[model samples]
Target: MLAALALGVKDLVGSTGFSGEMLLGLIAAGYAGTDFIEGFMEKVPLPGAGAGAVAGPGSTGSGVAVLPDQSGNGAAAKVAAQMEANLASQLNAQTSQLQADIASLKSTAAAGSPETSWALLTGPSAASLTPDLVARLFVPATPRANIRTHLPNVLAGLRSCDLIDRDMLLMALATIRAETEGFVPIDEFVSPYNTDQVAFDKYEPGTSTAVKLGNIEPGDGARFKGRGFIQLTGRDNYTRIGSQIGVDLVGNPTLANDSILAGRILAQFLANNEDPIRIALADGNLKVARRLVNGGSHGFDRFKDAYDKGLRLIPEGVEI
Candidate 1:
């Protein structure tokens, strides 16, 4: 059917009276009609207005003439135009309402009468999440002193994954506190762990033999070799993660230590491992990540339990 139509168009264009430009216009109109014939009538509109207006090629005709049903044809175009205008008006009204709501929320947040925290966390309706709880969370943990040294990189890692959204990002940070009490391999917190060399050595290994036995290399080596966040341990895991993220984890383990790089890798791991996480979350796999990292009695719900505890410690208004 289309072939014959195309041949007819070709003949029409090849004819003497038809100019090149007219032929082009006819072909375009035919093409558009073809689309309309393929159950695309919804896009065709009523007759003459707005998006429905179909001028024959370059012709400036009002389209009422070109329409087969001229008398009622203009009505469809007018209707389509009115419908478009109505939709635009509704959208504008909705947008204004949403903006007003957002402004009101911002004002409420800025009021900072200690109730803001309560509203943000416990919902405006909840009774719990008292002011004291909020204070406990946001009052700062004596600065942890080491928080600045190690947390930024960890945050960078989370940000890289685009998982730095409020809920999960805070969850990850609180999980960090549960994991090592902010004792990153960085300078500030490195002192104590460094003192306990033997214990550290037992856990952090330098060689492939150490990795096989599930031991990590301590200090910068262990940290950069994949410690925090997703805990990208072992050469095998490194290779696998590297392949997955398009990063050379095997060649440059140091990238893991560089918060930004590490955060991205961790984010990739979490997002890509959604199915496993969903299953773990369903099965109450608190220690699902732990199992992935260390493979022990740790089950799912490990992170959830820690998060609950951390939430208790957190103050209102201050996000996790």
Candidate 2:
């Protein structure tokens, strides 16, 4: 399949070398065709849709084509309603996931400490996890001067989880500031990576198998592209992490978008493994984040700084 797609693409590129407007149209048409072939077409109503029978075209717009309600035959309007409800629920679930990811990112940025703050924030996100005592203690005060925009929610999440004490939280924040220049995205601090290390955060492996047959660049061939918060990269790491987490991490690369899930996976690896720690402690601690995110620890000494920084991010008097 990949081979076919690649060949088709190559031929398409070679045959036309089409420029500007025509190429744009072709790309758009191809995408639309792909969408139609997928299940997307099933859910989409024709333009200018309404509840019932198709009305004559008017200046306003075209009316939707409505099939007769199958309810009289046994499939009731209730069935359709139920399906609508189900779709709504699924959409809500997806929305919640998106919100959670956004909230997690915002909280992590605000809270400062990656480990304690994130653990604290996410644990209490669910109603079931909230403790009565902690809920009472949670003040509705405005966010402190040091905290960023989402500080309240982050603290709320922490309180809900009962993960850390106030003193510890402060310590975590300070640590975070020190490590990341205040929870900024890594890209702002680091340059584009030079090494072809394992793809971490958003790695997308190729779906079609035939990608390698013609003019195929292996790096561009869609195998184990890195992605996500910790940017878990490399084929070997993906395989191992997938096995450990009981998830098809490589198979379903999009799992990285699930922020809590991503964090859980990272915690499992970093908190559980010694090798990662050792790698982080090498290289005179020069390369910290790179080592952990890229697993440079496994084969090289490029992560000592990451370990030290992580430790420093821990608040005073709190032991790792």
Candidate 3:
């Protein structure tokens, strides 16, 4: 079916007027949201995207005429134009066919196709991610120096969540660093937000975001406020994430801040359903990743900066 679909799309492309220009834009844009398409798409190229145009018989790679313009006639220029036209036509045909094949593949796998298939990988060792490095990217306060102790947990979470990709790890680390204000691994605390104690007090029950997260109890705001490295928030979130990671975040909200569990929870959120964060990381779209994590771009610049620093520390192929 996929093969036939590609052939059919190719036929339509030949009959229709999809230009090379459109093909280039479509291919680039498609890379943003889809997977399994890039590998096949790599085989296709736009006129300029591919190597220089190759002239037909008796023409060189430069597409220069083998028969020189001995008479200073513009024969060479005409030959070059012909070569360009040929290359453009060739590239367009290939690109159109590949695009069709991609569409067919997407359709065939629609039932099981993931929003994005982030690469499954094994990243650097837990030892590789050091406390000093964490301090630099996230550097905790004098009292919070034990952040590195959770390295084992972070590694374990990566294995459980299968977020071994360097890019995915870096993205997760960056966000975790920012969300916890340098891996504090505790609940949010802001006296101003609540006349009482701690962070997330501003989120009373009935508030849209809180209500959406099912924080319906009288003290739900304080009880379920953002915790964990990624700052898991609200009663609904606590219950949901708790079930997945095998913890009792809903009952013992403080556990979300446990150095070890916090790391696991962060990884869990990244690899969870549709794995939007993983998808964003795969596309190198940190901005979108931030939006997915925070529902907005709050502190996104800080997140991106930390992620960049983490990238420098964690090199490629550092296994286990």
Candidate 4:
């Protein structure tokens, strides 16, 4: 009987992830005698019972009756409650110590591995990303249906560029949210905010912006205008990214709007400037990170919002 009681206590402590000294102590107490075990068990309050409540005949505190001890009489209730209080205190201390030990182990492992430390700060691998998890990364204003629809292509895009890290994935998602809150590739809006003229005359041949964009002909600005998840703008970008992805973006610039192609383009663009973006992010400079892709703080607010949301919602080092 004593051995069986000790084994039962061992199983209970083991199930709670409480081990080492606590387990040994409980087993040792159990081996002392069955009377000791019975006394300890009697003090453990029933589930949902008040801390001061004691089990006794005709009492419904725990929806069950516990016969009072033959000896000790009324004093049994007081003694039992006090013993329970003491046991609760001990259990709480054990739990806190176990949690601290687990945290220390995690910190030590992270210190031993820089990659693990990065993962701890950023999040888990992109391969483990799910639609439910992605939904949490966006604000309530963004439609859930849109996130569900585009999630497959988004994962594909990340995989295409070998962007397995959660941080990189968040950066890509944040950029998409900034550029197109609708979660669809779109043509750049013709406004003073986007262009100097409604006709996009600012990017006409011989102009400085036009020269930088490789827009040598008329209508080149509007033709090679921003499109895709990250706004693959300008003739030079279309030519360069298209060549890398094996698409004739220079001839059919609008193809950047295609869901699959757009995702690929977005990932490729980020991969191209990954170094500068990481540097800025490491310094907690979201503005510089956005500038690396957008050339300015065009969508800084949206970008920061999405990225910050991701950092909060996505659990570190936890695969979803």
lDDT of each: 0.47, 0.39, 0.63, 0.71
lDDT of 3 by residue, 1-320 (tens): 33334324453244446434234334543553244355334434444532244344354432233445545777656655676677567566656765665664444333231111111011234326556545556632523455556666776777788778677667666776667665557767665633344356557775676667788877788788778778888888889889998988888999998877887888888777337776777788888888887777877878987786666555676553
Report the candidate with higher lDDT, 1 versus 2. Answer: 1
Task: Give lDDT tens digits, candidate 4, residues 255-312.
Answer: 9999999989998998999999899988999999999999899888989978876775
How high a TM-score does candidate 1 get?
Answer: 0.39
Candidate 4 wrongly placed segments (more than 4 Å): 1-128, 195-197, 316-320
Query: Per-residue alpha-carbon lDDT of model 1 for 1-320, expressed as tens digits?
Result: 33224335444333356443334434444454454454233333344443335454333233322232245667646655665676566556655554444444344334433333334434544433333332223223424555545556655665566664444544454444444443343211333422245423433566444566344434434433435445555556666777876888767765655556655655666666555655664565557744543444322244444455444344344422
Please rank every candidate by lDDT, starting with the best.
4, 3, 1, 2
**Global CA lDDT of candidate 1, please?**
0.47
Say which candidate scores most in TM-score.
Answer: 4
How far residue 205's Cα lies from its native spot in candidate 4, in Å, is 2.0
RMSD of each: 22.5, 24.9, 16.6, 13.5
Q: Tens digits of per-residue lDDT for model 2 on 1-320? A: 22224224443343436323224334434543454444333444445553343354331223223444445664435544665676567556655554454454444434433333334433533212222212212222412332343233334433433434433233223222333322221221222342234432122234232232121334432344444334444555566777776788667755743544454444444444434434533433434533443444331221232233334333333321
TM-score of each: 0.39, 0.30, 0.54, 0.62
Candidates sorted on TM-score, descending: 4, 3, 1, 2
Tell how far residue 119 is off in model 2, in angstroms.
Answer: 22
Candidate 3 weakest lDDT stretch, 10 residues: 113-122
